[model samples]
Target: MNRIRVLVVDDSAVARMALSRILASSGRIEVVGAARDGAEAIKMARELRPDVITLDVEMPGMDGLKALETLAAGPWKVIMISSYTTRGAEITVKALEAGAADYLAKPSNISEIDRVSSALIEKIEAVAASTAPLRRKKRPIPPLPKACSALLIGASTGGPRAIITLFGRIKSPLPWPTAIAMHMLPGFTAPFAKHLAEKTGLPVIEVTERVIAEPGFIYVAPGGKDMLISSSGRNVHLRPDEPKATYNPSVDRLLETGAEVWGQGVIALILTGMGQDGLAGARAVRGRGGTVLVQDEESSVVWGMPRAVVSEGLAHGIMSPEEMADFLEKIRSMA
Candidate 1:
C-alpha cells in the first residue's frame, strides 16, 4: 500500500518538527515536507501535492483560516492544528465549518506529545481515507407523525459544516426544542454553539447544567459530558458519567434518553460521523415508534454512524442537510 503523503505546516519550528516526527513514526504516513507559514504552506502544497496537510491554526502572516480558504479548494485534505485556548478553539471551529476535514488540539508539553501523536496520526488517516459525500437524488420523505416533542441530532467528524448547512436552510421557528450532540472536545463546544447561533440566526445555547428544554432554542451538549433529558421532556441534564464511550457528549446516550423521554414524539437525525455511536440510540427511537432519519452517504464526511442505522433498518429516511431542513419545516408547519 502507498503511504499517505503529508505536509506539515507550523510557524514554530518545534511544532513542525514534532508533527513531522509523529507522522514519520507511522508506517502508513509519509511526511513529504514542512512549511513555516501559511504562504509557504500554500506554495508547498501546490508543489508537493500531498494527500493531507497539518495546518497550524495561528501563524504569523496568513493564519490557518486564511490558508484554509485556498487549501479547501484543493484536492488535498486539511487538518487544523490548534492550541488549547479559547481563541484557538474559536478559530478551529471556524476552520472546521469552513472546510477543514478535522482538527487536533496541540499538546502543551513534551509529556503530552506522545499522547497527541496517536490521535493526530489517527485523524490524518481517517481524513485521508474519507471520500467526498456523493450528491444523491432527493427522495420523497415518508409521512411522519404530526407531533414531535423534540428534534435530537447526533453527529461527529464532518458535523459542524453539515449542521450549519441544515440550519441555514431553516428559516422558520421549530415548534419543539432542538438538541445537538456533536463529538467535540471540552473548551470547543461553547465556541461551536456561538458559531451556530451566528450562522443559523437561531438561539443556540451550550448546556452546562440542568435547564428546561424550550422550543425555538437549539441546545448543544457541552463537550466532555453527556446530556440527558428527563422523562417529562421538560428538563435537560448534563453529566460527565459515561466513561466507556470513545467519544464524549455521547450520541447514543443522548438519543437513548431522548427516546425514553419523548417516545413517539421523538425525531432523531443522524449526520456525518466516524463511528456507530448513534446506532443503538436510533434503535431505541425506532422501537418506540419515533422517526429516525440519517444523512445519505452522498452527503456525509464519514458515513459510519448513518450507515450503521441504515444497515440495521432503523432509519425512516435518508436525506441531505437541505432536505432535512425542509422536512423539519414541514413538521413545524403542521404543528
Candidate 2:
C-alpha cells in the first residue's frame, strides 16, 4: 500500500515542526510538505496534491475555516488541528459542519504530543481512506411501526457534519424525542449542541444531569459521561456506568438502555464514524425489534461504524443523511 501523503499547516513554526515529526513517525504516513498559514496551505495543497491536510483552526491570515471553504470544494480531505479551549472547540465544530473530515485537539504541552500520536495517526488514516460525499439516492423508506417512541443516533469521526446535514434537511418537528451520542471531548459537546440548535432551529440541550425526555427536542450526551434511558423510557440519565466500552458518551450504553426501555419503539440511526462502537448496541436494538438504519458508504466520511452494522445484517436500511431526514419526515407526517 502507498504511504498516505499529508500536508501539515500551522502558523507557528514549532507546531508545524512538531506535527510534521509526528506524522513522519507514523511509517504509514508521509509528510509531503508544511505551510505557515491558511493562504500558504491553500497554495501548497494545489501544488502538493496531498491525500490529507492537517489544518490549524487559527492562523495569522486566512484561518482554517476560510481555507477549509476553499479546500472543501477540492479533492483532498482535511483534518482540523484545534486548541483544547472553548473558543477552539466552537471553531472546530463549525469546521466539521463546514466540511472537515475530523479534528484533533492540540495539547498544551508539546511533550504530550506523544500521548496523542496514535489517535492522530488513526484519524489521518481514516480521513484519507474515506470516500467523498456523494449525491443522495432516493430509496424506499424503511417501514417502521406506528408507535415509534424515540430516535437515537450514534456517531464518531465524521459524525458532526452528518448530524448537522440530517437536521438541516428536516422541514418539520419530529414526533419523537432524539438522543445523540456523538464521540466528543468534555468541553466540546456544549458548543456542538449550541451549534446544532442554531443551525437546525430545534431545542438542543446537552444532558449534564437527569432530565425528562420529550418529543421535538434534541438531547446530546455530554462528553466524558454516558447518557442512558431510564427504565421508564421517559427520562434521560447522565452517568459513567454499565456495559462499559471504549468511548465515553458510549453509543452502546445509550442504545442498550434505550432498547431496554423502548423495545420495538426505538429507531436507531448509525452515522459516519470510525470503529465498531455502535455495532453491539445496534444488535440489541434489532433483537428488540427496533429499527436500525446506517449511513450508506458512499455518503459517509468514514464507513466503519455503519459498515459494522451492515456487515452483521443488523441494519434495516442503509441511506444517506438526506434520506434519513426524509424518512423521519414521513414518520412525522404519519404521526
Candidate 3:
C-alpha cells in the first residue's frame, strides 16, 4: 500500500525537523518535503501533490490563513501546526474556519512534542484514509417524536465548526433545554458560547455550578470540567471530571446520567469528533428508549463517535447538521 505523503511547513527549522521526525516515525506517513513559509508551501503543494500538509500558523510570508485560502482550490488536506498561546489559539481557530482540515497545538516545551506523536500519527492516518471529503446522504427526513423534553450533544476535534453549522441552521429557539459537551482547550468554551449566541440568537450559557435548566436555553459544558444532569433533570451541576477520565467534559457521564433522569423524554446527539467518547453514554440513551441522532460521516470532520453509535445500532438516524435542525423543528411542530 502507498504511504500517506506529507509536506511539513514551519518557519523554524527545528520545528520542521521535529515534526518531520514524528511523522517519519509513523510507518503510514512519508514526508515528501518541508517548506519554510506559506508561499513555498503552496508551490510545493502544487508540485508534489501531497496527501497532507502540516502548515504553521505564523510564517513570514503569507501565513497559514492566507495559504489555506490559496490551497483551498486543491483537495489536499491541511493540518495546521500552531502554538499553545492565546494568539495561537485564535489563529488556529481562524485556520480551521479558513478551510484547514485540523490543527495541532505546539507545546511550549519542545520536548513534549514526542508526547503527542501518537496522536499526530493517528490524525494523519485518519485524514489520509478518507481521501475525499465526506459526502452527505440525501435521505428522507424521518417523522418526529413529540415527547422529547431535553437535548444533549457531545463533540470534539472539528466540533466548533460543527456546532456552529448545527445551531446556525436551526431556525428558532428550542422549547427544551439543550446541553452540549465539546472537548476544547481551557477558556475556549466561553467564546464558543458567545459565538453560538451571536450566530443563533439563543440564550447560550456557559455552565456554572447548580444552574437550573429551563426550556429555550442552551447550556454549554464549561471547559476543563464535567457538566452532568441533576437527578431532577430540570437542573444541572458542574464538577470536576472523573480522576481517571481522559475527556474533561465526559460525554458518557453526561449522556448516561441524563438518560437516567429523562429516559424516553430525551434526545441525544453525537456530532463530529475523533473518538468513541459518546458510545457508552449513547448506549444508555438507547436503552432508555430515547432518540439518538448522529452526524453522518459525510457531514462530519471526524466520524469516530457517531460511527461507533451507528455501528453499534444505537443511533435512530444519521444526517447532516442542517438536517438535525429540521428534525428538531419537526419535534417542535408535534409539540
Candidate 4:
C-alpha cells in the first residue's frame, strides 16, 4: 500500500526537525520534504505533491495564513501547527477559516511533542481520507444566512469528528449559548464531550437539568433522553425527558423546542447522518423565521437529514461541517 506523504513547514529549525522525525518514524506516513517558511512550503507542496502539509502559524515572509490562502488555491490539505500563546491560538483560528483542514498546538516539552505528534498523525490521516478529488479552486461566497441567536446542531454517524471540526472554525465566547443533540450510544457522551472540548478549546459537558447556559460552552444532550431548551426571559432551561419520538435524544425534538422557545433566535444545523431525523425539525426552525444550515451532500457520509432540508428549501445555507461554527458566529454577529 502507498504511504501517506507529508511535508513539514516551520520557520523554527527545531520544530521542522522534530515534526519531520515524528512523521518519518510513523509506519503509515512518509516525510516528503521540509520547508522553512510559507513561500518555500507552497512551492514544495506543488512539486512534492504531498498528501498533507504540517504548516507553522508564524514565519518571516508570507505568514502561514497567507501561505494557506495560496495553498488553499491548490490541492494540499493543511494542518496548522500553533503555539499555546494567545496570538498563536488566534492565528490558528484564522488558518482554519482560510481553508486549512485542522490545527495542532505546539508542544511545550519533549513529552508534549510526542503527544502532539501522535495527535497530528491521527488527524492528518482522517482528513486525508475525507478528501474529495477535483475540488473547486474558487469557492463562491454566499451571503450570510439570516441572523439567529440560539443554535441547534444535530449529528449522528461520524458525528464526533464532525462536531469537533465545526467548533474549531467558530470564535470562542459566542453571543448566545449553543446546544448539540448527538445520537451516540449511552456512556459515550461524556467522553465525546471531553474530546470535543479538547479539540475546539470550548467547554463541553453533559447537560443536566437547570445547568445554566453560557455563551462559549456547549450543553451536549445525554443519549438516553429527548433534549430541549425552555427559555424564560434570557435564562436557558434544560429539558430532558423520556423519548417522545423515534430518535433518542431526538434532533427533531430539540429543533422543534428550540424554535418554539427561542423563535427567531434559533439557527439549526443538520450534519451528516444515516436518516432523516432532523428534516422535520429543520422545518420548525425555518417556520419560526430561524435559519437552517445543512452539511453539503458531497461532504456527508449518509446525507439523509441535510439532503432532506436542502431538497425542501428548508436550509438557508449548505456548508461543510468545518464551516458551521464560523458561519454561526457570522450569523450571530449580523444579528
In terms of lDDT, the best-performing candidate is 2
TM-scores for the candidates: 0.97, 0.96, 0.91, 0.57
Pairs of residues at least 3 apart in sequence or in different chains that clash in candidate 2: none
Question: Residue 56, candidate 1: how far off, in angstroms?
Answer: 0.7
Candidate lDDT values, in order:
0.90, 0.91, 0.84, 0.75
Count: clashes, candidate 4: 0
lDDT of 2 at 323: 88
State the displacement of the C-alpha of residue 71, model 2, in Å, after optimal TM-score superposition: 0.8
Q: Write the per-residue lDDT of candidate 3 for residues 173-234, one digit (tens) a residue.
A: 88899999888766567766877798679889989678998998999998789989999887
Error of 3 at 147 (Å): 2.6
Worst 10 residues of 2 by lDDT: 237-246
Reference-based TM-score, model 1:
0.97
Candidate closer to the true structure by lDDT (higher is better), 2 or 3:
2
Q: Distance (Å) between predicted and true CA of 145, model 3?
A: 0.9
In angstroms, the error of model 4 at 4 is 26
lDDT of 2 by residue, 126-170 (tens): 989887667767667678667779999999988999999999998
